[model samples]
Target: MEFRLIDRIRERTVLARGDVRLGIGDDAALLVPPAGQELAVAIDTLVEGVHFPHGTPPRDIGWKGLAVNLSDLAAMGATPAWALLALTLPRANAACVDGLADGFAQLAQEHAVALVGGDTTRGPFCLSIVVHGFVPPGQALTRAGARAGDAVFVTGTLGGAAGGLRLVQGRLPFDPADEAHRALRARLDRPTPRVRAGLALRGHASACIDVSDGLLADLGHLCAASGVGAQIDPNALPVPSALRGVFGSAAARELALSGGDDYELCFTVPPADVGAMQAALAAVDGKATRIGTIVEGQGVRALGNEPLAAARGGWDHFGL
Candidate 1:
């Protein structure tokens, strides 16, 4: 049964890469990195109900499990190369395995990421993936390079995924068939990793991070790493139409400030280079909204009407 499951996965996802000396069916994967490129690796694990709702589609779970990890690579401005999956199932169910593989392969092929090796076993339902990518030496974006006076920016929209989760939980009322609702749900279920945006920001962004644990939490991390502070203008935040359509301004603002699972890139760029950086990103069809600036302080602070406490709380795995 296990062999059949592995074969089913193998048949579904056959990403080809020349750097892989040996792929699946081996004890381990053999890989060769291109010369002068640094390897960027990221791993994430998702379990039923915690990372996603219990009844979410197996395909979506599979896709999201890999998508979050890829978002990490994207923040580093890396080009994806290979992946390793460790999937645990409640039972050996063929349909679930096939659905999961289809979703994983779909996104892997989109990023040209080769799934080289992995393991599967009977256990609580969980999915873990480790992705490997490459970046040129001294070109990788990091969270420690931010400086005071740098412009703080974010890619794509924010709070849509959190709003979608709220919609799913029935906390936010909306017609399921509404286009905005559907868009929000899609953002939550299958997030688009800002890989191209990150690539374009390479050599331009002083520091970068993917917003996983809400804007405040993740940006706070970047600020701490860079030894600077951030000042955000509440009026300048990019409000997603889906989030605003369902909730009022205050609720939407809270969602945008502290809601988790958005998976958008939050970065800082030197002031002098901001115009060229924004133009480069626009050329790639990446929407970057400047929401704030780095300032000489200790942590993130709000500059407009909203108080600093507005963004003080976010997703904490152990926080009740």
Candidate 2:
């Protein structure tokens, strides 16, 4: 059963990449990395309800499982090359496996990333993906390079995913088929990792992070790592129209400030390079909004010199 289930996925997601010497049939697939480039690898696991909602489509789950890990690589200015999918099922549902493989394959094709190899097992319903990418040596972005005078920027509008989850959970009222609902739901389910933006920011951004744990939470991490502080002006926050429409003004602001799962890139660039960075990103149809500035302090704060409390703002895996 396990072998057949693995075959179900292997059939749907096979891709031919020249760098792949061997793929998906043997005990271990082999690969050759591009010469003169450093490898960037990241992995993530999603359970039934922790990373995604219960009853969500298997297709979206498969796409998101890989997308989130790609977002991590994106944060480091990596170009995706290959992936390994480890899918488990409570029961062997071939249809669900097909849907999941198709979804994962769809995004992998977009980035030209091939599925090299992975394992299958009988366990709780979960999906795990390990992705590998390459970046120019000494050019990868990290959280420790942000300087005190750097400008903090984020790609895409904030809080749409959280708003989408609200819509899904019935906390917000909206028609399921409406354009507004679909947009928000798409943000939550099919998040576009800012790979292009990350690639573009390589030469300019001093620090970068993908906003998986909310802006404040993730930025605070960047600041802490760099030993700097940040001041975010609420007026500069970029709230998605869909998120605002579903959440209204006040709630939208709150959501934009601290809602997680958006998968957008939050990065810091030197003040003098901000214009060039924004222009480069804009050329790719990527919206880079400057909301804050790094300062010589301990943590993050909003306007009027108030500390941005960490408690109710971001997603903490095991918090109160």
Candidate 3:
């Protein structure tokens, strides 16, 4: 049954990339990295109840499983090339396998990522995916390159995913006819990995990271790595009006600062290079907003000189 499920996934996700000297039917994948390019690889494991809710559609589960790893590659300013999926299922349901394969393939095709190899087993439901992408040597973005006086920027609006989670958990009222709620739910279910924005940022951004955790927490990581501080303009956060409508303005802004799962890119660039970076992202249909400035000090704070409280931090796997 596991072998049959693997066959279904292989059939659905077979993309022919020249770099793949040998693909799925073998003991191991033989891949050729593009010359002079640095390979950026990232892996993530999603468990049923922890990463996603019970009863979430299999298709969405598959997409989110891959999207999260792709976001990691995006942070490195890499172009995705291949993926390996290890899925653990409670039961070998063919319909669920098909849905998962179809969803995973859809996004992989969009990014030209081929599924080269993977494994399957019976266990508690989970998906572990590894994605490999390529970036020019010496040009890949990292969290350590930021400098004092660099501008802190982010791609896309925030807070919608938190609202979506709320809706899904029944913590917030959900009206089927309300487009805003529907949109928020969609954001939670299917995040858009900022691949193009990352590509555009190459040679432009000094440091980069994806907002898988809350912005404040991730930006704090960047600051710690670069030996700098950040002062965020609370009003400058791109909180969608739809989110504000559902959660109210104050709560929405809080969510934007501390909510996880947005999957947008948070990056830093020198003040002098801001216009060029903006233009690069614009050319790729990306929306970037400058929300803060990196400073010589040490942590993250609001523009009012008050530090963000530790209680409102990003998601911690161990709940520490």
Candidate 4:
């Protein structure tokens, strides 16, 4: 059967707000802030099982929901300003909901993001967040502007999250006393988004996208959208020091390139601005390493020039 449920929903539910210059279409929903201001927007969702395991920490769930939305705004090179939250719970537990709200409030306070409004409803456990921010006009980094010959770069190390997941599931043999294991486990619980580095790369980056869908998959997104391809050097991926001991070199490399939920920034910059970009990243105590180069093609290639396979076919709403 052929169905257009999504299209129907878009047609019916798309509300036209005065501030929304464009919505429900295009690469992103666009809004025009007051004159001399900028526009920033982000979307994130938390599902029952996919985002959080059963009986997961409520505080962490709250923190992660806000964090992921902020990560999206960060990817657009915007300074987060406001947020709207929506929640659907099968049965509301006052304590659990309060703890979640506390987590959200704390992070919002730290980032100076105001929670202006929200809605609550009854359904399966799910939470959605939309954050807004601002940047200089014509300065937002996007996935559509990358050009061939641009250098690809990623911030911080990778693979820690995947390693952490393994530890949580008891899938990896590890000593409880090992500091490495402890660190990787923490990474899975809390991920730091590269908001500062993304803002710094604004003018320098020809195209940008957060590493939410693994390095290779996200880079492929940049390529497909920009009409370009990339050659990623396997050796160039920065795997966290702690993860190396637990997973070894080959496994670490795979995780770094294919693992999702890193929440880091992967962007392309012009060769000449490399120094400035590096300098800017340094302010945030973040490191940027060039891992590949953009070329005229349609997908991403890994080392030895082989096409990189999608890890779990990227993050999908339904299932992999």
Candidate 5:
């Protein structure tokens, strides 16, 4: 079946009050940021063969391109506002592009964000989304604020995506008939960025970052950027029930600790602010579990004061 861009948008897009002005067919979209809010901007690129496996669904690619950028905005506690899309396609196929646009519009409507500007180019299939958001000045979260003795926390579970990826590649023995396997595959295909949780933790978290890389690697980043070290309890890392069968016990722990692309939030808050942080995140139905504490050292250490080792391999731009 062929899908037209405008038709797909009208069929799938849900308009929001803040998503004012014109839409897809207009020469350009017009958006007005709410009063007294500083604009937060982030851009992300997804190359078909590089960022995702070849022939991945166009809808998912569109959603993820925007989702990852939104995750960056979430880390800064920004309220999403506008987006600009830059699409590169090898061919001028309307159906494929429309399917992608449909995915993008679906997410934009759900988050009350609007598509303002973008470009279309000819190349191997690739997507770049530049997302815009708003935050009150002086309240945007950053990685520079974490201090020694602060508690580090993460929302939701980890490792399921990595395990799910393995399943998708036919490397794991997941039963396609099983509902749980399907769910795991879905998680890997389309991750839920914890935008609400990040927004809620804005004033409370001293430092924050979304877990794009594995937990240990990403936390190490926060520590390095903030000039501190961290000690994470292995047991505290959340692993979903569905992943247990796929990765087993020890392997699951490793995946939870080092698996990347979960897109969950990993942040630090002062001990005194813990209660308030918990209360704020509760509204989103997400729990902020204390997994580690910042220290004056140079790197991350595990529960036994030993350097944390990745159960799986680290993410490398070059060949792994």
Candidate 6:
């Protein structure tokens, strides 16, 4: 049954790459990195009822399982090349396998990422995915390069995923026929990884990190790594209109500050390079908004906003 499930995945995701000398059929994958390039690899594990809610569809789970890993590679300004998936299921179910494979393949194809090797087992539902990417030497972005005078920016809007989770948990009122509500739900189900924006920022950004654990929390990580601090202007955050409309400005502001799973890129660039960085992202059909500045300190601070308390609180897996 496990072999059959693997066969289904292989059939659903058919991709060809010269670097992938040997793919899914073997016990190990053979890949060759291009010359003058550095390899960037990232892995993420998603467990049922932890990373996602109970009763979530297999397709959405597959997409998110891969999406999260891709976001990690993007944070380093890498171009995705291959993936290996280890999926666990409660039982052998062909329909569930097909749905998961289809969703995973859809995003893999978009990024030209080939599924090289993986494993399957009968256990509590979970997916562990490893992604490999490549970046030019000395061009990869890292969290430790931010300078005290750098400008802090974020790609795309925030809080939609938190809003979607609220709607899913029945904590927020929503109408099935409303497009705004549906959009929020979509944000939670299928997040767009900021690969292009990361690429655009490679030569320009001094530091970069993906907003998986909310902006404030992730920014705190970047600041800590760079030996710097940040001052965020609450009014400058890019809050989605849908979230503000449904949750009101105050609640939406709080959500934008600390909502997790948004999958957007938060980066820091020199003040003089901000214009060039924005133009580069714009050329890639991406948008970046400046919300703060790097400063000399130890952690993140909100500027004259009562929401500093909320900014300090974000998703912590172990409640640490």
Global lDDT of each model?
0.87, 0.88, 0.90, 0.76, 0.80, 0.88
Tell me the spans in candidate 4 whose CA falls farther than 4 Å from its real position. Answer: 1-34, 173-178, 313-320
Q: Which parts of model 1 have CA positions greater than 4 angstroms off? A: 304-307, 310-316
For model 3, the superposed segments whose C-alpha errors exceed 4 Å read 310-316
For candidate 2, write residues 1-320 as lDDT tens digits: 35677788889998899999999878888999999999999998888877788888989998999899999999999999999988888888888999999999999998999999878888899988999999999999999999988999999888888888777777766477789899988988999888888899889999999999888889989999999999999778899887777668888888888889889999999989988998889887888888989999779998677997754533336646
Best by TM-score: 3
| Per-model RMSD to reference | 1.8, 1.5, 1.4, 7.9, 3.2, 1.7
- Candidate 5 lDDT by residue in tens digits, 1-320: 11243444444544555445665556666776678889899988888766666767878877888888898998999988788777888877777877787778777877887775666777788888898888999999988788999999999888887777777667776688977787777767688878899889988999999887789888888888899999999998888888887668888888889887788899999999999999999977878779989988778999789998765532344535
After best superposition, candidate 6 residue 261: deviation in angstroms?
A: 0.3
Q: Tens-digit lDDT track for model 3 on 281-302?
A: 9999998999999998999999
lDDT (C-alpha) at residue 36 in model 4: 82
TM-score for each model: 0.95, 0.96, 0.97, 0.85, 0.90, 0.96
Which is the better candidate, 5 or 6, if ranked by lDDT? Answer: 6
Off by over 4 Å in 6: 305-307, 310-316
Q: Which of candidates 2 and 4 reaches a greater lDDT?
A: 2
124-241, model 4: which lDDT tens digit per residue?
9999988888899899999988888889998888778777767766678646699999888666656776777778887889989888768877888888888888988989998998
Between candidates 4 and 5, the one scoring higher on lDDT is: 5
The sequence of per-residue lDDT tens digits that candidate 1 reaches over residues 167-207 is: 88787674677998988889889998999999999989999
Best by lDDT: 3
Model 6 sits at a Cα RMSD from the real structure of 1.7
Clashing pairs in 6: none
Candidate 6, residue 275: lDDT: 93
Question: Which of the two, 3 or 4, has more TM-score?
Answer: 3
